[model samples]
Target chain A: MKRRNLFIFAVLAALGSGPANAACSFSNEVPIKVLSAAFEAWKSVTDAMAECGNVQASLDQDFRLKQSAAFAANPALYQLGGVANNTIPQLLNEKRIRPLNDLVEKYGQHLKPNQLIKVGGDIVAIAMMVNTQEFAYRKDIFDELGLDVPKTYDQVFEAAEKIRQSGKVDYPLGGMTMSGWNMALEWLNVYASLAGDSFLNADGTPNFNNENGIKALELLKRASEYMDPEYLVSDSTFVQQQMQQGKIAMANIWASRAGAADNEAESKVVGKIYTAASPLAAEDARPVAMLFWDGIVIPRNISDEAAEAAFRVAMEGLDTEMVQAHNDDAVWLIEGYKPGRLAEGAVATASAQPSPISYPMTIEMGLIHSAIGNQISGFFTGAKSAEAALRAAEEEYGTAAREAGLLQ
Target chain B: MRFRTFAAFVAPSLLLMVLFIAAPLTSVFVQSFFVTQPQIQRVETERCTAGFLEQQCTTEIKNVPVLDENGAVVTTTRFVGLDNYRAVVRPDRAFAALSAWDWQALMSIDFWKALRFTLTFTLVTLPLVVGLGLAIALAVNNTMRSIRGPVIFVSLLPFIVTPVIGALSIRWLFVGDGILTRAMEAWSGTEIAMFAQGWTIELLMLFYRVWHVAPFAFVIFYAGLQTMNRETLEAAMVDGASRFERLRYVIVPHLMPLIVFVSLIHLMDAYRVFEEVVGFRSQAHVISLQWLTYDLLQPDDAGNRAVSRASASAMLTMIGIVILLVPLLRKSWRDHKGAR
Candidate 1:
């Protein structure tokens, strides 16, 4: 009887383990056509949701399905992971991309995972990096500033100053100066312009204490005169909306972010508004931009076949009709800047122009961008002198990178 | 056999406490001390521009491996004795030394100034949340049968709402841009910084704290209040006692232990207020203890372990809490013992 009980137990143990393995072994090789349909569904949901950035965030099952399939097919080809404000973890995890490097070498003919992620992190589409577009003010603010649409940062600033000096508005400039994050981006534009190419070295070391960096600080300090003291802590999007309503003169904001800022129904300044370059302290530097992104990543445990199938499904999802429509309407401003839009309406039309720019992890650029923002916040707040703040910022950031084990 | 039974009974609880609670706590604390590899250090030095190299245009930025006072590599947050406590005592060694971003916070002497106000808030608010909770509990206990469910739930609304949203609702209601703001400006002719002024923050805290806390406190007190004998209250009333005298002689005595329990719990929760203030803070930085603790843990460019500093602050906070609460605990306990 005891021997029979032991045998029964052995059989039960084997059966108990089957369910977990069954989930992992599930097939992800849905055809391109099915994937195209999925892409449309995803795009529709995304447009309707409007606010959510990742499906995994709001819609778990779909994100999981997309992630699992991508992992099953080619785990290395997809996946981007990082913490908010925890860039160090992202950099450290870059070592995990080595298999991906080998995969890119083998599949150089198809797509670049990094560049595709730049546009959007959906399954079917190859994410594009360069996403920007222009917006305009409504009629009322346009007439009040006596400002015609300006093309350059110089023209915009002049218009802003004219509007401010005219005493028509309460707030002169409406832009974020809070959390040292938005302010950090503004600082990056200034540094990238003033410090020229020297602020960044080939391997990603910054030239922050350099004269160009100081010049960038000085420029930010000058802009501080127009900023409200509370600007340092206001929500970035909310501030931009106030600007759209002609509450402030001008705000240099994200292209994807312009939807919330545009007051189509009630905005007096809607048609008169124009998007301009976030200019530089030095004339040579162009407007700086980067892709705010998310991507599907496969956990390392899946089989080779499953991984490849998942990658295919994920890419197909990105390319689908609904997903692209959602991206075009909600996430991507398709006119001035096009991401993965092949189709003009939503899905990328077959004849659409290929996107320019790169995505995923850019370790070197990240190092440069991080330093500029914090340093600039300090400059505007007058926490320290421009020279001293830049100098200290240089030391702190360089050491921080080295200590986080990113820089050798 | 008895010893074995006792051991068996205690072992599971002890093991669980160690495994689930103590183990994770110890691990997080230990992690604060150790810096593992795969961490990158950001660029700390920049080149001098042109002729500026003549003076201090360049100095080799220090990335000296973090060291202990003895100049040994200190990797973990050990019990560094009173060194942490001394940080509070020594103005130079306070949080001001570690964060330059916070350097702008030091211009006003209010960095340290908030402590006096915070203590006053603690002294006032803790009792109010408990006192009001008990009063509501007593009222609910004596309520007509028809309104009991509604009364209990209506009192509990503040606790269920997420504090962030609750604070937000309060802010929209009271803010300068909202209707109340315009009315206040028109009638009172005064500008108010809700987050900057200590009183405004205290009022916001009292409003929200009472809201989130009253329900739980009421439930606890309500359960305790249910056991209150009608015979004792009737005897007091028949003895020619007035309402105030009846409450003082009968009800206050019954509710003393409940008050102590609620105060202890609320005091601990109040010390960790973070999310609400970050959501607000418009003009002035009203630096709180939790905010300072977050600064230590926030990943820096160096990615170095802030374990020692975090551990030290935690230890000091624990001590401060104990010191503040000792008198109240003793007084309450004494009252309990004397009543028994």
Candidate 2:
């Protein structure tokens, strides 16, 4: 307890004295949620596919498997599978694709042009925070309560009411129950597309104050009536306990976290948790979802040959065909995220009806995110009127963007 | 020979520090001065491994947009200096960024508000931790042997909880329909907004920090009490010293060094309040210089001026800490006077 107050201060001082005003880029938030799940899936496949136990070696083996699969199945994919520094000039100018380009031309010279990599399902976006659908809801609960699977927000509230009255369970709908961060993303969809108010206005001041924002909040707050008594008391993972134990009927959960929702191995409702789009803003509103991203950009220090080898290896994994062949074929995601222009023509083909949503590389995405976390929790907690909460959110979010230097 | 031996022994650590820690730190500091960074050129080359490396050969850093054949932006990285700071302090500029078609912060409100809120949150939480710590110290100073064990262990619970879990837990309790919330509602017959309300957040942070530190204070104070001379207190009592008198003339004086020591320790711990703040998601945040400084030591993820200016901000915080902490240290030193 007798901390040498000044001595400790002096130690910090000495440690920091080496540099003047140097900022450390230590970021903790990697791709989380389904994005993280997708990453894990990718890692698992890569590991299983390893020839030498070394990551690079495994990557090499997997790359060959995927490349061969692509060439044999769809021979036209030639260079399309590798770095497109040609399209995303920044990839080259920023040197994000240089090493790969060099390596493919150099170290990869050993490979025959006619030779194709074998496909074992290596390349794909995995391990992420993608907002998919509910994991542990009973079809019986909806059927017994005479409720249909809600397509839009209008049906959502009706279902909420019916479920609350059914009282067959302590709380009818449960999943990702207590995460404000989770609720935030769901709310963002409404605030942007459903709420009359957009995240940003023509003037760019956060416009969560618009009537649509209040309407969105009010609509979301409607669910509060049926939420578990401890809905706000336990975290999403914790609340998953209630759902997995059959205490609650439904929950809006991440595809990744759902594994834990039912403890896959021991789950009574095994294969029961289903992935669905986030609930709509209103019974009639369009379905909107928050994108979860797990982007992989190689560092700039590796040699050209290695970088190219790594790039090719990575490209082998991104193959949709390879992903679909995985043991868990449904687990291979390719829905939300849109690749940079380099692969637009190719991605356009992949980005059809269902795809894994990732970061949009847009500024408003961050703002909408900020607004959601701030307000959604406010509604469920009943701390503010939905209108007041939305307005407060606008101010805070707008303030954050300003500080981040994105608004102007 | 001595110098040579010492130099030889220290060489590895110094070299490692320079390569891994010092070099990166220096680069970060130097990069802060650059308004624009040099760009690497891309040359078309053959493929090796037939198609392996792509992004590895390149980096993500860019200062200008790279246009495609048709002249559309393939990648756009622009240089906006001091603007990040100006925007952070200037609400109007911050607001403009908010207008981006996206909901993300372009340059404005989020960072400023987060920074402001973080600072305020840290400032308020520090005192509560120290005050409660003092009270806990007093209680444990007199606790029976049997009760002290359980009290200390329970009090230390917050420290044992990881920041992530603690943060999630705080979210749960602060979220809607939490047990604490419902209980308060039943008592007051009115809603108590702990998470959304700015003031309630500070109290939450205080509770977290105080809860975490109370055990440490209890142990130290109890030990200090055990070490106290009963003769002096008995003599004071025999001379008709009242409770307050003995406490003021003896106990308070005796506790001064320990208090300053504990206060300094608690204050430092309190200043580094990233956990409690992030835990509670307190709307009004006031991040400490320490947290800011620590983050600045890393790379800029946001690619904004604030993150870029982080080095300068970190240096500023370090300077400020030196200025503020030096005085408190001197005062503590005075308390330990005549030790030699």
DockQ of all candidate complexes: 0.09, 0.07
> What's model 2's lDDT at A208?
67
lDDT of 2 by residue, B167-233 (tens): 7686677665568887888999985656544456556666666666666765676677777889999
The deviation in Å at residue B12 for candidate 2 is 16
Best by TM-score: 1
Error of 1 at A271 (Å): 3.9
Model 2, residue A228: C-alpha shift (Å): 4.8
DockQ of 2: 0.07
Clashes of each: 83, 139
**Cα lDDT for residue A336, candidate 1:** 32
Chain A vs. true chain A, TM-score per model, equals: 0.62, 0.61
Cα error, residue A142 of model 2, in Å, equals 1.1
Please provide, for model 2 over A42-135, each residue's C-alpha lDDT reduced to its tens digit, 9 standing for 90 to 100. 4543322221111221223123223322322221122222211111222323223222334434433433331221111111111211223332
Which segments of model 2 are wrong by more than 4 Å? A1-40, A51-95, A98-136, A174-184, A191-218, A228-242, A255-268, A271-279, A282-285, A290-408, B1-204, B218-231, B242-244, B279-305, B308-340
